[model samples]
Target: MTALNSKTITLKQLAKTIDHSLLTPDLNEEDVKAGCELAARYQVASVCVKPWDVRLAAGVLAGTDVKVGTVIGFPHGSSTMETKVFEARKAIEDGAVELDMVINIGAMRSGQYDYVRKEIHEVVEAARGKALVKVILENAYLTKEEIARGSQLVEEAGADFVKTSTGFAPTGATIDDLKLMRESVSEKVKIKAAHGIRTLDSLLEVIDAGATRVGARSTAAMLDEFAARYPDRLG
Candidate 1:
């Protein structure tokens, strides 16, 4: 992964920090295929696709460094805990190496933290050794206190990363949220800021604020910027 708390980066390290997104509902199969190709060419961390497209992404990304990732409970975190676990297992079976699951937003806002913790823990258990679990707090819907608590819950549940928003949220990752999340969890759990982060500068800003991964759609542009600006990193 790229350095999470600094500005320094290499082309590959920068690429490794991006989860190139293709989770939009409007994308057709060909669009996803093309996106997978683009992700491979850019050498990004993974291609985060919808659950249905996991197999396609895995097939295309096989033998390449890019991994297959998909959402669980998706943009909304209303799915039942049992349903989320099943969804996670199914995605893993379909070759998803990473799973970004939305925390039960309503539950967190409702102060049902134990319910939230159990839900995340079950998914983590389901994904154990099979895939990495990243919990999306969907910061747009959470208060600052809720954000910190959610971050702690996610880490306590043994998730691999704590993510900001769902990209469908009204707002996405902010530097303050990133810093708070970083402080809430030990280095053991990394941070992923999604939604509205597109350019290299924005990506670096999040990383500098303690994000270890970022969900992005402009994989090409961001990597291109890195290449142009840091030619020495190419080697």
Candidate 2:
């Protein structure tokens, strides 16, 4: 596991951008609870776990500043729109503060732009202003044009954030993709550069390219290294 030890030198600054993750298939309720505890201890931005565990995380994190987050149609984005929407609404009702929904790769590849748009909007609507909606574009599977188009569609669908990958794909977030995504969206929308952001240089590149958030499981180690390297910069 990659640690959050970064050259930034400050826990407070690093935690603000990290989204503590616990999305592996083998992760059980106990693991999720432990992850939530770690996130709370670190005071990271949020704790992202399986959709089924959103309520549990919320219950554990209640009355705290840490937000509860989960993924919809995760790992695979091939699920029907109805299913994704159903999952989104349920997760929100279960106390999820953020929804990260993956886009259907086949539909996007087939040039079914409108279909993708509607799918995202469906989930966004289901969120009902309770949770922030983030559309994961799976950038590795698409061409540059497709990435740009996906970003536009996500923006049009009223999503709060546009994400790079689910990390199950062949490739993860890249600097080029981050630039394209940032360029494609409105300034009001946030850009999250996730997927294999294991190093300080890599994470900084994304932030410099306008990524306001990062999904990472290695918050603890990365921030530690960052703090050691740049002790004076961090609070």
Candidate 3:
């Protein structure tokens, strides 16, 4: 990865690359609203919330550039393909512009590559071009070969992005995983690095490693650090 000088990247550019996360299980309506508000204020890429909160988040972030995103099958990718498709359709109906769907880790580990690929394809079809689909590989459990294969499956399955982790796994996105994923996918397939990216330096490192977007719960702190370090660049 090439070194990125913080001075060259504007605050807005950095903020735009972040997908502010609000997928915690215990979060209530108030929490979702607050998260949406924060994303709007910060002008981040999107507010990735739970499936049920898509409408509320859309309402809160209305008139702002921040999009409404939701997870399908959530932390665990065990949901049946029908259920995931339903979730994708419902999220889009509820105004979610992006859908981050998890692949069946168990199935992938079991060598059910065709099943995983078909599931992703169905979810993308369910979106019907209304939302961008990001397929999460949950790399914490996969071997390097699996990661590479998953990246190929994502491209073949027509997903817009190949994500590193779901953030609920035992581990999170690593530089090596990001590098491998980048190498595995085609140029058109974007990368999203989620989990364990809490600091500005970490975010930049991943961006330099080939991530076009990120899922972050520490959106405020990181952006604040960027603003403080380059006050003149931030409006």
List the candidates' TM-scores in order.
Answer: 0.97, 0.93, 0.96
Q: Which residue pairs clash in candidate 1?
A: none
Off by over 4 Å in 3: 1-7
Clash list (residue pairs), candidate 3: none
Worst 10 residues of 2 by lDDT: 1-10
Error of 1 at 177 (Å): 0.4
How big is the RMSD of model 3? 2.0
Return the lDDT, model 2, position 52: 81
Q: How many clashes in candidate 1?
A: 0
Model 1 CA deviation exceeding 4 Å by range: 1-6
TM-score of 2: 0.93
How many clashing residue pairs appear in each of the predictions shown? 0, 18, 0
Residues 203-235 of candidate 3 have per-residue lDDT tens digits of 888988888899999999999998898888785
**Residue 111 of model 2, lDDT score:** 98
Local distance difference test values of all predictions, in order: 0.93, 0.86, 0.92
- Model 1 lDDT on a 0 to 1 scale: 0.93
Residue 132 of model 3: what lDDT? Answer: 97
Predicted candidate 2 versus true structure: per-residue lDDT over 1-235, tens digit per residue: 2323343325576678778888989998899988999888878889888988988999899877999999999988989999999999889889998989999999999999999999999998888769999899999899999999999999999999999999888899888898889899888678888889987777777777777789998777877777787768667
